[model samples]
Target: MAKPKILVTRRWPAVVEKRLSKSYNATLNPTDVAMASNAIATAFAKYDAICPTISDKLPAELFPQSRSRVRILGNYGVGFSHIDLDAAKAAGIVVTNTPGVLSECTADLVITLMLMVARRTSEGERQVRAGRWTGWRPTHMMGAKVSGATFGVLGFGRIGRSAAKRAHHGFGMKVIYYDAFPIAPDLAAESAAQSRDSIEAVLHEADAVSLHMPGGAENFHLINAERLALMKPTGILVNTARGEIIDGQALADALRSRTIAGAGLDVYEDEPTIPAALLQTNAVLLPHLGSATRATREAMGMMVADNLDAFFAGENLPNRVA
Candidate 1:
């Protein structure tokens, strides 16, 4: 039998790429640039499977207007909101995403963001780097205290639960979470977390909040002006989840008006394009580094490889979403 042809939309880790190339007829994107709609459509007609990362946007239009030969999509990341599920289903394309592999690393990043914003480390670094730092004073760069504070977690899934554990056990924080579905009682007890009925209640009570919800039309702007108003004037916000989960303009306004203390954001509403207002604020912004660790990334790639292996070998796919 001929080797199944596959297209990797972006660059992946070296070891996984080598393994994938040896197993299948794999083509890697040399430039590591995000594939355009036409390029994705072209790949759909040419390849048996196309592997994509979160950076690649696979909307409904990218799917073939007619029938498609693409049998499956091996998504490198956990989030599938970037790909249009309905369109993939309509085109008879199976979609699988990598999950559980990056949980610890991503949870670590959430904590890192929480600390960076609450302690104003980014602002302090900027001052020192720009030669604006003078001798230490009694009233320099005073920021919020994270230890023993109320840590609100949105979405109590694997990543959220991991972050709750860190906040509760590591920082001595009280973890309160809001999820549309119920979390296991034992898991909540283990993390010392209390589940809230609504997002508003968590916002009203927390000294610091971290978001870990999915992104799509339903949650396009989950944190708008009214939601921001529910938070305390000194509350800190951290987001390592989907960018659309929070309203960037509202967050920027809240930071400028001191309605909220500070923000730590790893993703943005638009990739590589930040809101002008946020850039000028003291918000600690990162270039979508939530699951960028070498180990985690390789694991994610191997997860995709495993799914593809099952897909071509006529075995059950482990992480099929569509």
Candidate 2:
């Protein structure tokens, strides 16, 4: 029998590439750029598995036409919002994402963004870079405090719990969170977080809000104008989750109108095209750096490899999106 054919989405670590080259017939994009629908159509034509990322889309229109082909989409990151699940289901393809491997890295990013916004690190950077920093004046570039502040977590998953641990243990923050399903005892005990009855209550009480909810229906634009308006004028918003969770236009308006004090975003509604108004405002914007760490990337890649090994060996996948 011949080896399985796989199409890697982009350039990976040399070791991983070498291992893949030995284990299977792997095809990589010539330019090492993000996979497009046309390229996906072409690549999937001969390959059995298509390694993808959150940026790649596996629409039905681009499904492989070969009977020997069945997808094992090896997503580099946890988020599968880019992949059309229904389309994949219709195409009889199995989609896999590297999930737990990214929780710590993303949690660290969320905390880092929150701290940056609360402590005005971005402003300080701006001041220093613009050569405007004459000295450390008493009231110059001063921002909110984190200690003794109330922290609101939107969805308490592995990443959320990790962030809550950092907030509670690192700082003396009062922790409260809202989840559709009640948080398990392990999480509450682990993070020292209190459960709130409603998301509104969490918004009302928290000095800073961090979102970690999974993205799907019923969550798109959950934090709209009205929800943003509910936050205190002194409240700070932080999101390392999906960009669609918050309305960028509403968030921009909120910042302009001072609806909320400030915000830090690791993701955006549009991946590369951020709102110009947000860029002009004091809000801290990040270019979707939630899981950008080198160590985390390697782990994600390896985990996907493990999932593939399990699948090819006729065992259960390590992390299944379905």
The candidate that wins on lDDT is 1
Q: For model 2, how big is the CA root-mean-square deviation?
A: 1.7
Model 1: per-residue Cα lDDT over 170-264, one tens digit each: 99999999999988899999789998999999999999999999898979999998999999998889998899999999999999999998889
**192-242: candidate 2 lDDT, tens digit per residue:** 899999989999889999998766665899999999999999999999988
Q: How many angstroms is residue 10 displaced in model 2 relative to the true structure, after the best TM-score fit?
A: 1.8
Where in model 2 is the C-alpha error above 4 Å? 64-68
The whole-model C-alpha lDDT of candidate 1 against the native structure comes to: 0.92
Count backbone clashes in candidate 1: 0
Candidate achieving the largest TM-score: 1
**RMSD values, in order shown:** 0.8, 1.7
- Candidates' TM-scores? 0.99, 0.95
